[model samples]
Target chain A: MFEGVPLTWFLIVATIMFFIGIYGFLVRKNLITILMSLELILNSVNINFVAFNKLLYPQHMEGMFFTVFVIAVAAAEASVAIAIIINIYRRLINIDVERIDEMKY
Target chain B: MLIMRHELLLVIITVILLLVEIFLPDNRKHTIILPSILLFFIVTVLGFIPGPTGELFGGMYATTPLILTMKNILNLGVLIIFIQSVNWLKKIENKGKIGEYYLILLSTLIGMDYMISSGDFLMFYLGLELATIPLATLAAWERFKEKSAEAGVKLIFTSALSSGILLYGISMIYGTTGSVYFREVMGAFNATPLQVLAFIFFFAGMAFKIAIVPFHLWIADVYEGSPINITSYLSVISKGAAVFILMIILYTVFYKIALLWRDVLYVTSILTMTIGNLFAIRQRNIKRFLAFSSIAQAGFILLGLIGQSQLGMTTVIYFVLVYIFSNLGAFGVAGIISNVTGKESIDDYDGLYRTNPLLSLTMMLALFSLAGIPPVAGFFGKFFLFTAAAQKGLYLLVIIGVLNTIISLYYYLLVVKAMFLNTSDQPIAYFRSDAYSRIGLLMCVAGIVIIGFASPVYEFILSLSHGLY
Candidate 1:
């Protein structure tokens, strides 16, 4: 149980993970690494949703439903992302964001 | 069940299309195109039939006349895109995958319908994800094209990042209000610091989708790389859907924080308009030019939002409708040219009037409409949006809007000049556009001309906007 763990603690962890994900997203070059960063961002939000549901409003399952949907959607998104990464790799022989500037303004 | 008639019809059609896709031979794939368009046409027509409107699934999904109207507008845009894409779909490179395009396209439409109808955060997120993920695949549609693949990657990356940010905001709202339902959240929402932070995140995420200035970096590249058909869809249909939902949420759920969001809109609108116009002036690729122009259009739509009244809502919706016609008209011409001649740069369009006078005319009309010139629906749309803002005593924003309109007219005229005034040693040769493209262009022209002169459409939208807030 999450008893005796203050909500602020969970909130603190999620916030850190979210920023770390954003940092990775900005700093990383490879497509898959950026995707992993996206996952980190999503998972951190998942943590926030779960902690809020279980701690703040124990009666309603709204946040729980939201978490389930997020997990499902994130999985779907990851699959799509991988498919796109593979497609990009095939066409260009690399997935580095730096190298993928074929259509820049 | 009746409340979501539009979504239900689209789902049925999608299922039928899937069944057809399963049974059809790979070589015979293009056979599905006509039937798919015909079926979707029926669904688009069915969407307009008056239907019962109310909540279902425990207040998660709801509908209203205004929502119905928005869905209808989207359906109209998709129908035009479908018609216009027939020529592109018939290409040798796109031969075998025609059915897949229709199926994916329909599913995304279904997603947008649900997104527009969503009454809760959960439904909204689901609809939003369903709407977006497949679009990345479509962006990468020409898998053999290097730029298309890159577009897919960029689109998916930015969308995933934006959605993550948006979900984080929703989680915060959930934490603060203890509910995700819009009605409940609306009652509980206040201008607390955490709630305001949540709103900023939500706005940023939606802004990325709408391609608002600060978050608009992904747009030009994605638009330039994707096929012209997909670019137009992204600019008009996808962005329009995001704006509709954002407006709905801000007006209904975040009305309590009006003062906060108005300030945000004011700053973003100015930056979005100025930056979009400045960048638009430099773009040579027609798609990227329109991309920046659409960003400026989004800024203008924000002026309507800042008004924060029924008139604002009406102008936003009306302007979006007018925008669908004008933007698509411009893109349709560009698309047919690109498909036929493989030329997409503004310089390539020189002396277009000498060879393809009709397309040049269509492009001119569309560009003029986009610049808010008189005798077009766009002028009326802009006039009303300015009126809405001026009603709110935001004269400064309105003036800035008018100035931007003039600047936009200048750049738009540059394109017009290339077509009409500038002579090229080698003009694009005349070739008649196919039947479908003509029909598509005709529809857009008809909408542009009729929607402006016909006062009933505006009055109808005004009536629908009255009780929405």
Candidate 2:
């Protein structure tokens, strides 16, 4: 019922998840791992949306609708992105972003 | 009801085109072009239809004649990109994906159109994400190229970070204002510290898309790595659309805090111009150089925003229109040369005039326009921007803007000199452009020259700004 916990707790949890995703994005070398981190980041966004939908505007479900759309789009994006990553690996045989700096100054 | 019909039409056209692209035979994939052109033409016509500005979906969606105008300009730019890309797409190894590329580009364009019309924070963020993620994929569409992959990674990472920051800002604003509607947020704006912090975060996120100074590192690298056609999309249409939305949001929602944000913009504008031009001067790769040049042009556009007047809005719109043509022309020429030689460096252009006078002349006109030479739209573009800034009593910004213009001229001339003065060791083979690309370049050239002299074009822009408020 979330009776004891304040609404801010949900935001704090979302923020923590968001930061973890950012850390993974910066640290991970594998392309797929970095992509997983991006998913985590997007999930944190969903958490915020759900929390706001419950706490701020209980009468309207617009935030919930937005979260649903975000999830659908993220799934589509991840599928296409993974396919591209696989193609890149087949061509180049690696997914290390650092070594892929062929066009860097 | 009319606006709704217009939006519905665009959505239907986009979905139909996407389906046809997905199912079309590879050899017959050129069929997608007809639908795209038709859709763009329809959207352009719809944009001109007069109607009342109002809200939909419980005030989350808003539309005005000005937003329609912005959407139409973007559609026009996208159509130009499609035409210019056809020849370049034919040369790429995986030519079949050209249809998919157009689809993604159209979908992203739709997102931008919605973003400009969104009246609430939720829709705005969704639109931003939709517009950004596909672009990241487009940057790396060349699966075999390591540079392309790196560009995609960089873009996605930066985009994710900015989205997080922007989300945090939105949360903060909601916490303080208890609402995310633009008008509601405007009513709640005060000198509160939370409001200031939220504004800073919001500015930083939007600044990343606009490629302001501190956030511009990804631009040149991405431009160099991406295919020239996609780079053209990134440089002109994507950035221009973001600036349009930013202008609307800042002017409508955050106008009361203009005094605070204007100071932030002033410092950022000067830094963006100086840094962009300074680095642009040293780049050897034509794409990278133009990347920085585009960043510097963004700073000039920001100068217009600092004016905070109807004149400023009109100037910004006009400059962006001119920029769409000038920048696209430059990239189109670069695309032609790059396709032929697989070379993007200034050195490769030596004796270009001797090899292919027509290509060289187009390149010359593009660069001259970019340098703000007379009889070209870029001159009028910069003139209007500086005039807007001067009206705001921001004379120092205008002076720096002019100095930066001169600095830009030096580098652009360097490319011209290479093409005209130096001789190559081997005779460069004359490259041929397909009918579509040639028509595209001709269209851009015509836009640059004729639009420069056309008073009615300026008048239309003024009328659009008048409708904004």
Q: Quick one: best lDDT, which candidate? A: 1
Query: What is the iRMSD of the candidate numbered 1?
Result: 0.8
Best by TM-score: 1
Q: Model 1, B307-371: lDDT tens per residue?
A: 98888999999999999999999999999999999999999999999999999999999999999
lDDT of 1: 0.94
Span of 10 residues, lowest total lDDT, candidate 2 chain B: B1-10
**Which residue pairs collide in model 2, if any?**
none
The fraction of reference A/B contacts recovered in model 2 reads 0.26
TM-score of 1: 0.99
Docking quality tier of model 1? high
The local lDDT score (0 to 100) that residue B413 gets in candidate 1 is 100
